[model samples]
Structure formats: structure tokens, C-alpha cells
Target chain A: MPALRLALHFIHRELRNRYLGSFSGGLWALFQPLIQLAVYSFVFVYVFKAKVPGANAPGYIPFLVMGLWPWNAFAEGLARATTAIQDNAALIGKVALPREVLVFSAVAANFLLQGIGFCAIVIAMRVFGVPVDLFALPLALLGFVQLFVLALGFAFLFAAVQVFVRDLSSALPQLLMLWMFSSPVFFARDALPERYRGWLDWNPFTYYTEFFRAALLGAGSFSLSSTLMALGVAVIVFTLGYAIFRRLNPYFEDFL
Target chain B: MQSPVLVEARRLGKTYPKVFHRRDRLRALYRLLTGGPGIDSTSVLRDVDLEVRAGQSLGLIGENGAGKSTLLKLIVGVLTPSSGEVHVHGRVGALLELGAGFHPEYTGRDNIALSAALYGLNADEARAKLPEIIDFADIGAYIDEPVKHYSSGMVVRLGFAIVAALRPDLLITDEVLAVGDESFQKKCVRWMEDYLDGGGTLILVSHSMYHVQKLCRQACWIKQGAVAASGDVFEVTQAYLAYQERKSAAQPVRQDSPSHAQEFYLIDLALNGDTADVPLVIDQGCRVGARVHVHSRDGREPVISFGVARADGTSVYGVSTEMEKQRPLRVSENVYTVEIEFPELALLPGSYLLRAHALDTEGVRLFNTLVRSITIRGESREFGLIRLKHSWPAANSETNVAP
Candidate 1:
């Protein structure tokens, strides 16, 4: 219970840290995603003439919104959580607490904000006659939760490693970018050549983006096997990441 | 009944990996992951055994790089032991460094919440103690301002205030008293005394032997990653002070070799028949005999003076042969010896300097000086430099004493 309380405190602190000095405050959490959605919609729909590869595909804006919000949460969460321990070296050195709380709060704070933005944008698309599945929002949140677990796994792994290898945080942005493009964040998996389409399944993020599109926008069909696979991957990654974190936890102060 | 042991360590040790290059970090990471042999490392602390019971206070005394801080960190669980084990029971409130665990960008109020959380206080409990902590910190409006803009003293005040409010089972502090202002320091010392009186435990690391002696009943002297001495507060601190005095005296003396060109110069000074550079450790109330041999450039008799001063240079007692209308015995043509003895030394237990000076016949001008360190070893709760002889007449009358 204390660890849970500490984690919540840190999550609150993290959320405040993001919007403390900003002009628009927590509104930026909602507006930042909206603006990003606008820009991506412009560049991909208006400029590249990109489209969903199906006859009854949802509008390009809704499809993009469904995937981009989750991708932003995953990428941004990983980026912030990777530096969680390194950024808090001062706190870690002086105070004795569960170090996992720091990484958890970072990833959780990002997911919370983007999760809110994802729901808000979905409802907005529904109001604009885009035919978003309003009744399936809770189901979509389950997929979002699954993605959160996956991101937390990577967060733990990267946060521990970043304490030793300082270059991981520096190189994480480019790596997340490559990971984003490799998944179906901007383009559909079917849009990839037939041979390369199978490779998309290897990226852990591929299931979440495709799942969110299938759940919220009704663009793709959901498969039970894929859901089971995603659940297994999340659990395995979480266990492994947490195991590594616990192993490296005691040594973090030494390295820092 | 004996109190429970609040802290127990068995041959505790800590070492930091020597990561000079990026490649070494990777290698160390690999070694840690694979449970391989340790990477190249420097051991800061090793084989330190310590035990402290509930309601007992222990002072850790050491030089700058002497591993006292590392020992504190290890006990506080901020650092893991590399070789041995340390177990601390109950909640520990630690102020390891000035403004430790404080985010510079966060306001003092916010940091208080963070610290409370780190100490495992729930939100309601933290809220309940907020006003008390802020009041104790007494930084005025700076509580709401970011800690970055506060002075070092403010940071220490805030840190101490939070720890005080926590009222943890065991309080471990490292030199936090040295930073506060005079009144705040008095307040903190008073608070610590009260905390201890309430049966709280304490482990303090400080260079101030005075504070250590005042607050702690036991002391551990660490030297170069090892326990040089550990025992009674008075004894260990005296030993530590003697060691420090010897270290400082080991430096080259400024005075040139005995030169007869001056009007008066000292030939030698002996204490209790011993003439050596190391300090003489003696029990309190022991007879102390001093002999000063002076060289006179001229045949004129010179005045010899002896003075006892606390190690910090506060003069305790000084006397001149001229003051007592006594003259030195002329042992030779130019050499004179003055012997003085205190049948019962009244000085309390602490380190003091015994100085011998040669001055003009009138005792107007000092010519040469020689200093020797003397450490008084005893167990007494008595205060001040010299223990004044007094009698408590009220003890004989039952009515006069409080029931």
C-alpha cells in the first residue's frame, strides 16, 4: 500500500512537472495531441494521399487518430520512462524508496495524459459524423491498458539500462521513431508489400495499433489469437523488464 | 530489560566500481547482469561492525575521506553493502546531505510532500504534518518558492524540519548541524535532545567533537575505511582528537632550531618526564609536571611561562615565574630550567595543549614557544574546561533536596 501510494504521489508529481510552467497548463495535454493529429492528417492525407487499404475503411482522419494517439503514448512514455532513473539520480541517491515507482510514474503519467487525449479525440470524431464506435470505447481502453503494460515493460528495461549506458537515452528518440514507422502508426499493415506485412507482426506495437484501429474505428477485424499473443507478450515483457529492474535496482546508486 | 537493537551490522562493506570510461560501464553492466566477477572497483568501506540499541545515540567521527558518510548511507539503506550485511529496524529518517533528495526546481512545499511520500506517509498524514514542517522550517514565504532560489541555510532548515516532523524511529544525520545559523542550530540541538529524551535512537556523523560529546554516549572513530577506535564517547573522541593533533603537529614547525641570537630561546620542554612529539594521555586529576629549559643569549635571567589551552586555542590557565616571584634555576652558563607541577589537574576530559614560553626578565616580550598536546581521559558529565571544586550541602539535608 505504501509503494502504491508512493507511486501515485510520483505520478501526480510527474503530471504536474509536465504542465507546471506551461501557459495553457493541462489543456496542452489535450491540445498537443490534437495539433499533432492535425499536422499528420495534413501531411499524410493532403500531401501523400495516403488511404486505408479497404473498401469500407474509416475516414483517413479517424483511422490516423486511432493509431497516432496510442503511438504517441507508447513512444513518449518509453522516452520519458527510459530517463526516469537517470533524471532522478539526485533523489535516487539520497532517498531510499522503491525505484520502480519512478519508472512506473513516468510511463503512467504519459499514458494517462495521452489516454485522455485518445478518448477525447475519439468522441470528437464521433460527434463529427465519422462513425467511431462509441459503444466499444471501454473495449478500446482495454487495448490501451495492454499497450500500457507493454510500454511499462520497455520502460523498466530501458530505465535500468540507461543508468549504466548513458547513450541509450540520447539514442532513444531516433529508435522510437524507427519503431513508429516500422509499425502501422501512419500506414496500414496491408498497405505494406505482402512479404513485409508479416514482419509487422514481430513489432510489439503492431498489435496495439491494429487493435485500436479495429476496436475504435472499425477499420480492421480482431482475431482472438492475436489478442492472446499480445497478452502473452505483455505479460512476458513485463515480467522480464521488472526482473531486470529488480536485479539492477540495488546497483543503480553505485553507477550513478 | 535491555532495549532492542535498532541497528546491527556484521562486517559491513561497500565498494564502488571504477568506471572511468564508457566501455567500462558497459563491461560492468554485463558483469552485473551475468553474475560474473566484480569489475575493477575501489572499496570505500570494509569490515565495519556496529550495533546501536533503541534510545542510544552513536556519533561517527572521521576525516573528510574516512568513509563515515558511506557508513551512514549503508545503514540508511541508500547504498547496498558489497561484502557484509546491515539491518536497520523501524523507520529511518535520514538527512545524508544538505538539501538531499530535494528537486531544485520544485518549491519547498512540494518537496515536503515528496519527502513525506518517500518516508511512506500517506497523503492525509503528510497534509496533517505540513503546517508543522513549514513552521519548523521558518523560511517565511520561501516555502512556496522553488528551492533553487533558496540559500544553503534555507535548504538545511527545510531538510531538518521535514525530518523532525517525521519523528522516525531512528534518526540518522550527517553534519546537518554545521550549516544552520546560531539560533537554528540551538533549536535543532534542543530538538535532538528532546528526541533522544523521548527514547528515540540516533546515529550522527559530525566533525564537531563538541556536538558529538554533548549528544552521543558512544562514538566510533573511522579512519581510512576502518574503525580506528570505538567505545565511550569521551574516550573515542579524545583518541580521535589526539590523532588529529598529531597529524597537524606532523607538519613542519615554523620556528627555526634553537638560536641564541634572540634574547631568550627555549632549549626543551618536558611533560611528566616525557619529551616526545606525540600527545600524553592521562586520567583526570593526575599530577602533571612540566619542565622548561631556556637559553639566554645574555647572562640575564629569563622569565619562563607555562600555559594550558584547549585544543581549539581557548586559554584555560597561564602562569609566569615572574607572577609567582619565582626564578628559574641556572643549570649552566646560558641554560636555565624551570620546573612546575600541578599536584591535581582540574581540567576536564578533552584534548588540551601544554605550552612553554621564554620571555624577557620582565615577562614583557615573548621570545620562543614550544607546544605539546595533552589529552585528558575520564568519564564525567561535568561541563566546562576545568571542573570547579564544589560541595552539595543540600544532599546532607533531606528536606532541602526535592522529594
Candidate 2:
């Protein structure tokens, strides 16, 4: 409880400082993703007539919403985490804390924001009568949690590296943008050519979006094996991220 | 049994890789992995052995980048030593730099809780002490305002207030007193005195030797990543002060005036055998002697005189051989040397200037003047340029009647 309380304090501070304190600042967190959703839905659903492969409906908006929300969380969390140490350079260079707190709190703040976005989307989807599968809700929650852990691992790894190679922070968003496009948020994995779909199978992100589809819309190939595989990848990423982070922890102050 | 040392650092050294390019960092990383020597590096701190027992207060004195802050960081475990280890036995609270741990966007109140948590206080404990911390910081309604809105002095006040409330067994502070206003600084010093009085250990780093002498019993002067000197506060601070004076005075040596050979002139002046090359530092009540060598065109005697003044040029005492009616003995055909000695120098602990002059025989016109700076070093808290030797007489019973 004490640790949780302390973590909550940091989380609260992080949220107020980075997001919710100012009117425009609080608006940005919600507006950014909503804008992204609007743009992507406009281009793919209305313009390209992108089809949902296994949805109860013809439109892809509900399908895209399920996956895009989680991807946004993952991407935003990692982006924030990448600069966790760099952003708190003043604090990191001084007072001693479990430096991981910076990374954890960044991810937590993004998760809270993403969680709110997800609920809002879900309510809208249900109101629109897009077949909501309550049964797969637990699996969807598991997928989101997996994404959080996976992002945390990457956050730890990049947060350490960003201190040394500051270019990584500026470079990450481009890479993440490409990564988001490569994952199947606008189209189903099957919509890609067979060869590209095979490559997508190797991409861990594909499974994350696909898992969310299964949970929310019950419209994707719900493979228990792939779900377990995603879990394995999350654990591996977290471990590797933590290892790199701890190895570089002592050298962090040197660069600063 | 010896009242366990609150902090001990043994052969502590820290070297930062002189990374210039991305390749350099990569190579350093490779070396770290392969156990290879760093290609090029700078030792910011090296072989610093220090200890502070419980109830002992030590001051770290050094010029900027002399590793005083680095050593304190090592002792506080903010930065790990590269070669050796620092063992701190007690809970340590360090103020390495003002607002270092504060989140600028968080209100002062929030940062107090957050910093307390960072300093190892549990949430409940931090909450319990919040009121006291807020009261000590004493910034009023500004406490609820985001820290970025507060002034730098307010930040230090908040940072220091948390440390004060925590009251760690060993307090390590680096120039925390440098930022705040004078009144706040006095408040902090007063609090520190009380902390030390309550049997706490302290390690302070400051450019002000006066504060070092006031608060610390022991001091260390770190120079170029090594312990230049360390011992009693007065001795180490005096040595450091002397070194600074010498470095600043290393400007071009004064050339003899072109007309010196045509008139009576002072060729050289030395204070207790120390020339102008090094500043003189002497303890109060210590013997201070000035030797002046003068030259005369003829074997005619000139009035040799010298005076002591505060660094501000306020004259403390001045005397001339003419006033004493003494004749200078010629050491050579045209050279004369006079020794003016103060068996028990009465100047208090402060920087002062000593000027010796050669005047015409009638003492009406000055021929040449040579000046040297001296520091009277002592641990006394007395004010004034000179320590007057006087004692208070006990009041008689008759005089004790109610006024």
C-alpha cells in the first residue's frame, strides 16, 4: 500500500505536470488521439472503403477503434518512456530515487489516458450497435496489460540509451509511425498480400492489435497460441529492457 | 565503541570517460563489456579518504570543479564511485543542488511529498511530516502554487525544508546556502547549528570559508581530484585561502620603478620570510614580522615605515622608524634592512593588507612603497579588525543593586 501510494503520488504529479494541469494541455491528450482516429477513419473507412474482415458490420471504424486505441497507448507510452530520464534530467541528476519510477510513471500516465479513450470508444461502439463481445473482455484486458508491460520494457531500454544518444528520442516517433502503419489497424492482416501477411505474423505488434480485435469485436482469428506467444514476447521484452536499464543505470549520470 | 563513523569513504575515485563522439561512447561501452581500459578519461575525483563520525561536522572546500560536489555525491550515493567505495552508515540527506529533485510543474506541496518519497520516506511518514515541512519552508500561500511559479529562493527553501524535517543522521549539503536570501540563509544556519547540537553529522561544501569555519569542526580541501589538505577546519580553510590568494596574485610581477636607483626605494618586502609571491596567513596572537630591504642613493638613512590595514584599506596600525626615533643600520654601501615584528599580532581573523614604505630622511615625502596581502586566520566569532585584549571585571555586590 505504501509503495502504491508513493507510485500514485508520482503518477499524479506526472499527469498534472505533463497532461491535465493546463486547459490546453488536458485537451491535447484527448484531442491528439481523437484527431488521429478521425483522420485514419476518414481516409481508410470513408475514402478507401476499407473493409472489416470478420466484423458483424461492413464498416471498419469499430474494428479500427479497438486496435488503434491500444496501439496509441503503446506508442505514446513508449515515446514518453523514451524520454523519461531525459525529461527528468534535473531530478535524475540530483535526488536519488528508484530511477525506474520515472519510466513506470510515464507509462502509467499514458495508460490512464489511453484507458479513458478506450472506454469512450467502447461506449460509442455499443451505442452504435456494433456487436460488443463481453465474453472476450478479459482477453482484451490481458492484451492491454501485455502492451503496457511491453512498452515499459522498451521504455527502460530506450530511456537508458536516450541519455547517451539523444537523437534516439527525436528519431523514435518516425520509427513508431512506420511501425503503426505496418501493424493492421486500418486493414485486417488478411487484407495484406499473403507474403506480407506472413511477415506480419513475425511482427509482435500484429498479435497485439489482433488480440484486441478478438476481445472487443470478436472478429479476428482468436488463436490462444498467438495470445500466449504475445505474453511470452512481453515477458521477454520486459526482462531484456530491465537488464539494459540496470546495466546503464550507473552510467546515466555520466552522460548528463 | 568509537561512536561508529556516520560516513566513511576509502580511496574513492570517479572517472568520467572523455566521450567526444558517438564512436567514443560506443568504444567506452565496448570496453565496459570487454573489461578494456578507457581510451581517454578524466578523473573528477580520486583517492579521497574521508570519515565523519557521529556528531562530527566536516566542510568541503575547493574551487568549482575541484570535486568537492563529486565527493559529496559519492558519499550520498547519488553517484557511484568508479574505483573505490563510500560507506555511509546512517540515513543521509543531501542537498547537492537546489531544486534538483523537484518537479517544476508540481505544486510546492506536491513536490514536498514526492521528494520525501524519493528520500526514502514512506507515504504515511511523509504525509505526517507535511505540515511541519510546509511550516518550515514558510512560503505561505505560494506553497500551493506550482514550483515553476516560485522563485529560485523559494525552491531552495522548499528543498531545505524537506531536509530539515527529515533530519537525517548525516546531512550532506553542497552550496545550499548560496542561493537563498540572507535571512533564509541565517535561518538555515541556525537550523544546522541546532541539528549539529542534536548529535547529527554534517558535510557541507561552500565557497565561504567563514561559514565553513562557523559550522564545521573539520574540513577538507580538494584540488584537482585529490585531497590537497584535510584536518582541522581552521587549518584547512586557511591553507585553501592562502592557495587562492597565491593563485590570484600570480599576475605579472611588479617591475622596479625606472627612477628607483636615483632615489631611496624599497627593493623587497617579506612577511615572516614569505614574499609577495604567496599570501601570508597567520593565526591570531601569532608572531608576525615584516622584513623590508631598502636602497639609498647615498649612505643617508631614510625613514622605514609599514602599516597594517584591512583588505578594504582601513588602517589598523601604522608606525614609522622616525616616530620611534630609531636609526636603521646599513647592511651594505647603499642597502638597509629593517625588521618590524609583532610578537603577538592582535588583528582578528580576516584578510588584511600590509604596506611598507621608504620615506625621505625628514619623513615628509614617500620615496617607494611595497604592499603585501595577509590573512589573519582564526576560529573566533569576534567582529572587528583587531582583537583587543580586555577582560570584563566581576560586578561588586554593591553595584548589583537594581537599576
* Most accurate candidate by lDDT: 1
- Residue B38, model 1: lDDT of 79
Task: Please report how far candidate 1 places residue B5 from its true position, in Å.
Answer: 2.5
The candidates' DockQ values read 0.76, 0.57
Question: Evaluated with DockQ, which candidate comes out highest?
Answer: 1
Model 1 residue B161 distance off true place after TM-score fit, in angstroms: 2.3
The whole-model lDDT of each prediction reads: 0.91, 0.83
**Residue B318 alpha-carbon offset, candidate 2, angstroms:** 5.5
Q: Per-residue lDDT for B99-135 in model 1, tens only?
A: 9799888999999998998998998999999999999
Query: Model 1, residue B222: what's the lDDT?
Result: 95
- In model 1, which runs have C-alpha deviations exceeding 4 angstroms? B246-256, B321-329, B360-366, B389-403
lDDT of 1 by residue, A1-256 (tens): 9999999999999998999889999999998888988899899999999988898888788888878899999999999999999889888778888888999999999999998888888887788899888999999999989999999999999999999999998899999889888888899988888989999889998998888888877788779999999999999999999999999988999998
lDDT of 2 by residue, A1-256 (tens): 4466657777877777776546697768777888988898899877887777653653577788887889889888899889888887787778766788889988988998987778777777788877777566666676778888988988899998888778898999999989988888777887887877788877778888877776777675667788788889989999998988888788888887
lDDT score, residue A68, model 1? Answer: 88
Question: For residues B199-304, what per-residue lDDT tens digits would candidate 2 score against the true structure?
Answer: 9889999988768988999999999999999999878887787777677568633534636566699888889987755678777789989998888888788899
